[model samples]
Target: MIAVDQHPLGRRGTVVANNAGLVVMVKELADGDRAVSLTNETGSTATISTTADALGIANRGPYRLKDPWTKVPSTNTTGTISASVPSHATVVHRTAPGPAPLPP
Candidate 1:
């Protein structure tokens, strides 16, 4: 997890890549208090208010030619979310295969 306080305009947070080769970023708003924008490798972005209980996500993609997707918290005003490539996008879902099983 990463944290920022009073970030500067156009200031983007660190980029973290998981084993799946997806790049993740957190951009803080210079004007708003504790407001941040989270962007995935596909350029999808989500803006959330740290103070208030609000969250929004906009899916932007060149990977998958599909409608954008958005999600908001149901119960709590604020919550955490994890995003991966859209199903339509071509992604490797299975892990590397081990050596072929020996004949029974």
Candidate 2:
């Protein structure tokens, strides 16, 4: 599952975590950082933090937060997070399991 923000930032990684307030490009990623690439409703994709707040950085994982499906990423600005991040928690954010089979 992935969350996509409907905003354009150059032409890089389109996939993004709507729950994340920041976006990233696939080319510039550090080792051990999990990123989810999402294409928004507008067809633009960006990389988003899969971890909750700073916890993603501390734990070396993607920034994962509450249910992102509940809301969409704000195109106006970086959405403010009402919740706080707890100490020492890591969540895995990766491509969904399995591959899409070609049409026979």
Candidate 3:
């Protein structure tokens, strides 16, 4: 909670999706990046999704996602930002436009 609030990308949030047990919020950063929040309000796990257009991000290239809480890295190349969130849990990600690095 503190880490998310204190992170620079975690400000200026705008709710993009809120329904079906999934709530999503987006924050545009100054460095051409985005902070996206996926919250699951259901008793069971849920899959939440949003688009780059919905996130107000103009660029359409591949994007990289890093979890502020977990420090886990992922990628999105489908213009869609989706996540499988645990019940009543919130997953926050930092999205930046770029290609994912090759895995060795």
Candidate 4:
């Protein structure tokens, strides 16, 4: 679970993709630190706005917001998110079949 702090700009909110490919954002943030977003899938952008939060998500309470949508998980997915700058992007290796047994 991720936590978000309320921005100084009157607790505005924005949906953003985290390193784990989750869609999350802060909703109805308080005057101080608070959480406001959550993601449900990969390869999707988090919607950030000053409006009445996102369509599917709603402010559950005075200092919290939640997504009313359900999420489904996938099997063929594995990756990591990083804010650190790298020299270049490269493929470390490719998938391969297991080795076959030798003759007896």
Q: Highest lDDT: give the candidate number.
A: 3
Every candidate's lDDT: 0.28, 0.29, 0.78, 0.29
Model 2 — TM-score against the truth? Answer: 0.19
lDDT tens digits, residues 1-104, model 3? 35556666556688888997789998777677778999999999988988877887645467778877676776655578888899999888888876434567
Q: RMSD to the native, candidate 4?
A: 19.6
* Per-residue lDDT value at 37 in model 4: 36
* Residue 49 shift from truth in candidate 1, angstroms: 18
Give residue 84's lDDT in candidate 2 (0 to 100).
24
User: CA lDDT of 80 in candidate 2?
Assistant: 20
Query: TM-score of the candidate numbered 4?
Result: 0.22
**Per-residue alpha-carbon lDDT of candidate 2 for residues 1-104, written as tens digits (9 for 90 to 100):** 23223322222344324343333223112333223332222323433343223323332222332333444332221222222222222222232111223567
lDDT of 4: 0.29
- Lowest summed lDDT across 10 adjacent residues in model 1 is found at 59-68
lDDT tens digits, residue span 15-101, model 4: 543445443454343333333333334343433222122322223222222222221211111121112222221111111111223
Choose the strongest candidate by TM-score: 3
* TM-score against native, each model: 0.29, 0.19, 0.78, 0.22
Stronger candidate by lDDT (1 vs 2):
2
User: lDDT of candidate 3 vs native?
Assistant: 0.78
